[model samples]
Target: MALTSHLETLKKKHRDMSEAIDVAQRAPGIDGLRLADMKKQKLRLKEEINRLSN
Candidate 1:
């Protein structure tokens, strides 16, 4: 049960990060480093979610 809840939280965070990245891309003068970091974090979350799913 705890694992399921944790997975859900991670999924939600991943979705939120994706949306943030999209918005940041549309904005002017966004920092490349920050965007890359966000993408990396999102990827990590996705990997964790996959691991837990299995």
Candidate 2:
């Protein structure tokens, strides 16, 4: 796959994860640890997208 495609995919993944986290945060009895993990994953995806774009 092309670099641009990879970047787009990463961005989409990050957005999807963010939305998921938001939903999870709003739900009752949500796990804080899982939300933290999702945030970490989002950060890592963003870093990867930045690296690939450069």
Off by over 4 Å in 2: none
Q: Which residue pairs show collisions in model 1?
A: none
**lDDT tens readout by residue for model 2, 1-54:** 787787888999999999999999999999889989999999999899888888
Q: Which lDDT value does model 2 have at 30? A: 92
Predicted structure 2: lDDT: 0.91
**Candidate 1: stretches off by over 4 Å:** none
Return the TM-score for each candidate structure.
Answer: 0.97, 0.90
Instruction: At residue 14, give the lDDT of candidate 1.
Output: 97
Q: Model 1 over residues 1-54: C-alpha lDDT tens digits?
A: 999999999999999999999999999999999999999999999999999999
Best prediction by TM-score: 1
